[model samples]
Target: MIAAVRPQADPPPEATRAPEAVLPQDVHATEAVRATEAAHAPGAAPATARRRPMVAHDLDGLPVPRAAYPLTRLPRNEPHASLDGARIVVSGGRGMGDLAAFPILYDIAARLGGAVGASLPAVDAGWAPVTRQVGISGKYVSPDIYLAIGISGTPQHLAGIDPHTRIVAINNDEQANIFNVAEAGVVAEWQVLLPALLNALDHPGDA
Candidate 1:
């Protein structure tokens, strides 16, 4: 015997159509959603509670310093050449031979409106002041022009000089280590060279 078949019913029109996406703003418009958001906000207070203002009292309780000493101004000495940001540095070393040579170095530096610097040995030997010492253990200088007279290019001494500075070396020994790093070099000693330089500065008109 054959069996009888029945027809199936179709889905409703609402089920067949796609639902519209709900925006966050649309959800927030509901009273329940708005209340939940208010509960999570930073430093949020209950709707029934009254808020109290906060005040800072740290400065009000802080102690101020009072001067207990006499008000006598100390006598200020004249300012000397500062090594900081010097455009031109005329530096010397033990090869300067004598303390007398320092005065000439100073004169040359004064003529050139530059500062005077010395190597550690020169400073240690009392040839120059400790303030004028330029080396690894002393002041670091970055001058545009570094007139290195009688200085041997030691690692310690070279460490204090800026790599960008243009070095001009003057020494009696042609094979001196200074020449290795010097942009310009002279085989003459500082004694002979400095005097001529000063003379040239003194008489610019003369060749």
Candidate 2:
């Protein structure tokens, strides 16, 4: 942190006089003349010293002590999931229609050895937990591959994603904003698309 110092007031000028010319051979005479001049010169009164006023800064009431809050431990249900370390992320959104499709989304992520994430609307609609939210208001993600299902790409949501991550967008709307940033896109309804994807995952050769 940088701090600024206040400028101080200038001091008063000192009293001075020109020296008298003295002969080189008359050193004692020159000393006598200088003594006479010093006796005749008017005496200057000593300047009165100014003392700075004592500044008593009382910080007694300035700070407010924080109150100790009661801590309660919640029951642990499952292992903690984080998006930052996830290599692949399969995310769902409001366009998936309902929370019923989350199981299929989760299954796809599990099969691919990835984490499950959700858009803000999907989390708000109770389709996924708040911890899985991905957006400017949620956790930032930089996974190797990001699969966006039924999610419209909003600037706020995209802001949380790393630009280097390969994006794959699947949406019913062909003209979705997600397509602009996605490396690959598929336009299809999730109801038909999800089951087909699961089937492909089950039987890779048959797909």
Candidate 3:
């Protein structure tokens, strides 16, 4: 639904200033006053006329077109660098069920200082909101830690997450595809695992 933007050509430079006219003492003083008035004219100063507003180009009593300053920001080197704190991402797969448990996922994400995301199937099934979907067709997420629960790792789903990110998966099936990409795995159901996770977080060092 977006329209293509046409590239714009750079504007031409301003015409050079004419050499100052030499005149008698009184005439020279009057000319100086006129120059000051011209410099303080309304509008932006030209590149050459740092302290003065640029005079319009006059060709045979006719004025040429005027131009505005191109105040644009150039591309920076660290484009992907994050100015904010570290991010943690929690993504749910098909095992998350009808998304009736989304609140629990949101709560977990809040606890872990992260955002919530969902797999393609969960998004398609209307379990998770479209904004939270992760995959080629969804938004790409590059969080510091990626925790995937009840998910089967699909290439499409993995495309949304960074390859170098730390991944943790939770699923009952030990042979699930998600385990392949997970740095850590726990063979457990989310319904039970979530409570255990909450308890462990609440009571740290009390294993």
Best by TM-score: 1
lDDT of 1 by residue, 49-133 (tens): 2212212212122221221212132212434467787888989999988676677777667777788899999999998889999
CA deviation > 4 Å runs, candidate 1: 1-79
Clashes of each: 0, 0, 0
Please provide TM-scores, in order, for all candidate models, with all chains considered together.
Answer: 0.61, 0.60, 0.56
For each candidate, the alpha-carbon lDDT, in order, equals 0.57, 0.57, 0.52
* Model 3 TM-score, all chains together: 0.56
The residue-by-residue lDDT of candidate 3 on 1-207, one tens digit each, is 111111122212331111112111111110000112122122313112222122222122221122221213222233222212337877787887764666666655766667778898998888777878877788777676777888876666776666556566667675565555454445556665565455455544543
lDDT score, candidate 3: 0.52
- The model with the greater TM-score, 1 or 3, is 1
Candidate with better TM-score, 2 vs 3: 2
Arranged by TM-score with the best first, the candidates are 1, 2, 3
Residue 120 in candidate 3 has what lDDT? 87
Which residue pairs of candidate 2 clash? none
